[model samples]
Target: MAKASYLAGVALALAAGSALAADLPSRKAPPPAFVPPPPAFSWTGLYGGVNIGYGFGASSSIRGGELLTQVPGAGPFAGAVDVAAGAWNMPTNLNGVLGGGQIGYNYQFSPWLVVGVEADIQAADLRTSQAAGVSYISPVTGAGVTGYANANQYVDWFGTVRGRLGLTLPSWPNLMIFGTGGFAYGSVESAHRYTRFDGSAPLFATQASATTTSTNTGWTAGGGVEWTPMAFPAWSLKVEYLYTDLGSINQVGTGFYSAGAFGGPATMLVTGNQANFRWHTVRAGVNWHFNPFGSSAPVLAKY
Candidate 1:
C-alpha cells in the first residue's frame, strides 16, 4: 500500500509539471498589424497648356445724321446721310476658333481640395460684318439719290484673371472637378464709310471713314474636369467652359470728305456710337503636376 501511494503522488506531480509546460507563454509573436502610411499631397507646380475652342458674341446698332444742301451742278440737293455711322453691326454672334496658353500656381489646402490663381490671354480673328444700303433725296433738286455704307467691327483680343477651386476624388490616380470665377478685360473696334448724291445725279462723290474703340472690365465664371492617368509621370488634361459679362461701351467715331458743291472742301462729321456684348468660350488643355513632398520611390502611386 505504501509503494502504491508513493507512486500515485509522483504521477500527480509529473502531470502538474507537464500542464505548466504546455501553458508557458507562446514563443511565436502575434503578426504585426498592418500600418498604412499617410496620404500624399498633389498639385503643386507650374503648369501650362494649349486650349482650342469656339466663341459666340454680338454688337449693338449705331445711329447717324442727315444733311440737305443745293450746290452748282447738283440741283435741289436733298439727302439724309449718316454723317457718321462707323461699323454698324460688327462681328456679333459669330463663331470662331481660339488657341492660347495659361500659367498658374496651385496650393494644396486639404487632402481633397486645392485652390489656385491663374492668368491667361488669347488672340483670335473672330469678327462679324453687317451693312445697310443708304440713299438720299434732294427736296431742293426734286430728285432721288443713292449711296453705300458699311459697319464692320470686331472683338478679337481678351484676357482673364481667375481663382480656381478643385476637388480631389478618392478613386485611384488623381482626378478632380473644378470651378473658377474672376475678372476679365477686353476691347472692340469698327470701320465706317459714307457717300453723297445731288438728286441721284451723283454730284459730289466722297468717302469718309471712322472707328470706335473702348476698354471694359467685367466678371467671368467657369467649371471643368481634370484627369491624371499616370501618377509618377504627373501628366493631366482638362475641359472647361467660361461666360464673360463685359458690360457696355459707347464707340464714338468721325470722318471727313466732300459731298455738296456748296461745301468748298471736304466736311468732317463725328459719330456717337455704342455696343453691348457677351462672350462664351469652351476650351481644353493639358497640365504637368509635380509632387514636391512624396515617397522616395515614385512620388505618386499608380494602381
Candidate 2:
C-alpha cells in the first residue's frame, strides 16, 4: 500500500507540471517592429535670391585711329584720311561692385547629384577711362598745336542664363559644390572724344565727342559652393566666382582744326577707339527655396 501511494503522488505531480507548461508563452522570436527608413537629402525645389559682389575687369588694350574728313576748300581733303593714331594700342582696366536677383529650379536625380537652370539680372558700376595728349609744331604754318584723345568703357547692367551641375558627398548631404556656364548679355557703353587747339594769333579750338551703347552677348563659366543649414532648411547660402565676356565696343568721333583769322580755314578729323569688356566676379548670396527636403519628398533614403 505505501509503494502504491508514492507512485500515485509522482503521477499527480507530473500532470501539474504539464498543465503549467501549457499555460506558458511561446519561446519563438517576436516579429521585428516596423522601423521605417531614414528620409533622403533632397535639393529639389524652386528658388529666388539676391546677391552682391565685386568685379575685376580684364580689358586688354584700346586700339585708336584718326582720319582727316573735311577742309576749307572742299578739295582732296574732303575725303582725305590720315589714320595716324592707328598705331596706338593703349592699355586700360575697369572694375566695380554689382548687386542683383536670381531665379532658378533644381532637380535631384540621386542623393549625390543635382541638375538645374538659373537666370539672373544685375545692376553694375563697372567702368574705366583713359586719355592721351600730344603737342607738336605744324609742318605747314610753323605754329604750335595741341591734340587730345580720350576713351572709356562702361557696363551699366548685365545678366546671365545658365545651366548648373552639382555634386553632394554622402557624408555632407547639405553641402554642394557646383560648376555652371551659359549665355551672358549686358548693356555696354563706350565714349570717344578728340580736341585740337592752338595758342597763336588765330587762337581757335575744335572738339567733338561720341558715345556708343549696345546690348552685347557672349559666354560665361564658373564654379561655386552652396550650403543649407540644418536650422534653416528652407534657405541656402553660396559663394561663387565667375568669368564673363560681353563682346566689345567700337566708336567714332569727329573734330576740326580752325584757322578762323589766319587767312585760311583748315581740316576736319575723325577719331575713335575699340575696347572689349571682360571681367571676373566674386559673389555671395542667400536663397529662399520653395520646398526642399520636405515630408512629401519621393526618396526614402537608405544610408
Candidate 3:
C-alpha cells in the first residue's frame, strides 16, 4: 500500500508540472509585423508661374551705305566721297525692369532626370538714344560742311518657347539645375535721323523709322536653379538667366531736301539701316504645380 501511494503521488506531481508548463506564456517573440515601403518624391506635373527681372546689353547698328543712297544727289557723288560718311553704329546698353508669366509641363524620366517644355511672355521697358556729328569739306564747292545724326531704339516686349533638361541633386531631390534653349520672338522700335549743315547754315534733314511689333523670330538659350520646399511640394522657386537674339531689322527713312548757296535743293533718302535686338536677362519667380500623384506628402520607407 505505501509503495502504491508513493507512486500515485509522483504521478500527480508530474501531471501538475506538465499543466503549469502548458499555461506559461511563450518565450520567443512574435514574428515582426509586416512593414510597407515609403513612397518617393516625383517632379512630374503641370505648372504655371509669374516672374520679375532685369535685362541688359541691348545693342544695335545703322548701315552707313544705305544712308548715302537716300540722298538725292548721292548717286552722282557716290564715287567721289566716302559713302559710309552718314552711316553710324551704336551700342545701346539697355537696362530695365521686366515682368511676366509662364506655363509648362514636366516629366520626371528617372529619380534624377527631368524634361519639360515651357512658354513665357514678358513686358519690358528698355530704351536708349544717342546723337553724333561729323565735319567735312564739300567736294563740289570746296565749302566747309557738317553732318549730325540721331538714333533711338527700344524693345517693348518679348516671348519664348523652350525645352528644358534638368537633374535633381543626389543629396537633395528637391533641388534641380536646368538648361533651356529654343525659339524667341519680340517687338522692337527703331528711329534714325540725319541733318546736314553748310558753312554753319542748315541744309537738309532725313529720317527713318521701323517696327517689329508683328513678329520677330530668333534664338534663345539659358539656365537656372529651382527649389521645392518639403512642406509645400507643389510650390517652387527659381532663379534664371537668358540670352536672346531677335535677328536684325532693316529700315529706310523719308527723304527731305533744302537749297544750298551753289546748287538747287538736294533731295536725300536714308536706307540700309539695321537694328539688332540682343539682350541678357536675369529673373526670379515662383511656381504652382499641379501634381497628379497626390499632395506634396512625404514618402514613407520600410526598414
Candidate 4:
C-alpha cells in the first residue's frame, strides 16, 4: 500500500510539471533575426543622375554684337560706301527647355560644411530670333541712315565643371543648401540675313547671308537646396538656379554685288552680325548615390 501511494505521488508531480511547461513561451524562432536600422544619412558619396530645366537668356546681358547697315544708293557716289556697327538687343524671350545628366562626389568635411565637385552636360533649344530696322547717323558724313537687320541665335548644347560649397541646416539633417561656381562652356550659333535696298525704291536691293557657330567658354555661378529623404537614403533631390555666360558668335558677310555706287558686278559690300549670350537656368534633379554612408570617399571607384 505504501509503494502504491509513492507511485501515485510521482505521477501527480510529473503531470504538474508538464502543465507548467505548456504555460511558458517557446524560443520564438530566434527573435526574427535581429534586423538593425539603416545607417545615418551622409552626403559623402559619389552620385549620378539626370535633370530637366528651363533656360532663359538675358538679352541685356549680351553685348559686343554689331548692328549696322549696308551702303545706301547715294546718287553720284564715287566709291563703295561703308556702314557703322552698333550693338543689337535681342527681342524679348530667349528661352526654352533643357535636359541632361550629371555626375559628382561630395565629402562632408565638417558638421556644417560639405564640399564637392560636379560635371554636367546638357542639350537645349534656347534660341532668339529678331528682324528689325536699325537707324543711325553716319559717323563719317552725319547723314541719317536706316537699314534692316535680321538675326538668329542659339544655345544648342552646354556643359560645366563646377565646385560646390554647402551649408548644412542643423534643424534638418537631411537638407542642405549650397553655392556653386566654375568653368562653363557651350556651342553657340548665329545667322544673319540681310537685304539692303538702294535709294527710296524697296524693290531694288542686294541680299547677303552668313552663319557662324563656335564653342564658347565662360563662367557660371549658382545656388541650390538639396535633400535626402529618410525613406530613400541612397537618393537625393535638388532644386537649383544658375547663371552662365553664352559666349560670342559673330558673322561678317562680304559678297560681290552686281551694282552699288555705279561699281558694276564686282563691287564689294560688308555686313556684320555679332552677339554674346548669357542666361539663367532653373533645374530640378535626383541623384543615385553609390556606396552611401561609407568611407570618406564618396565613390567606389579608384582615384
- lDDT of every predicted structure (CA atoms): 0.62, 0.79, 0.73, 0.73
TM-score of each: 0.64, 0.78, 0.78, 0.75
Q: Each model's number of backbone clashes?
A: 11, 0, 9, 3
Instruction: Give the per-residue lDDT of model 4 (tens digit) for 48-167.
Output: 999999998765332222223334553334343445445345453468999999999999877688899999999999988777665566453354445566777888999999999999
Please list the residue runs of candidate 3 whose C-alpha ends up more than 4 Å from where it truly belongs after superposition: 1-38, 63-86, 200-214, 292-303
> Model 1: per-residue lDDT, tens digit, 158-248?
7789999998865633677889989998776665554544343346565555666766788899999877765444677889898876665
For candidate 4, give the lDDT of residue 204.
41
Candidate 4 C-alpha error for residue 57, in Å:
1.5
Query: What ranges in model 4 sit over 4 Å off?
Result: 1-38, 60-76, 87-93, 135-146, 200-203, 260-272, 296-303
Q: Candidate 2 — what's its lDDT? A: 0.79
Error of 1 at 118 (Å): 1.5
Summarize candidate 2's per-residue lDDT along 1-303 as a digit string, tens digits: 999999999999999999999999979988897676645667888999999999887755677755544354654344333334563567767799999999999888777898999999999999888887756654444567566777788899999999999999888989999999999999998887777666566577777678889999998999999999977888999999999998788766765554432334445454447788889999999999988774445555565
- At residue 49, what lDDT does model 4 achieve? 96
How would you order the candidates by lDDT, starting with the best? 2, 4, 3, 1
RMSD (CA, angstroms), candidate 4? 7.3
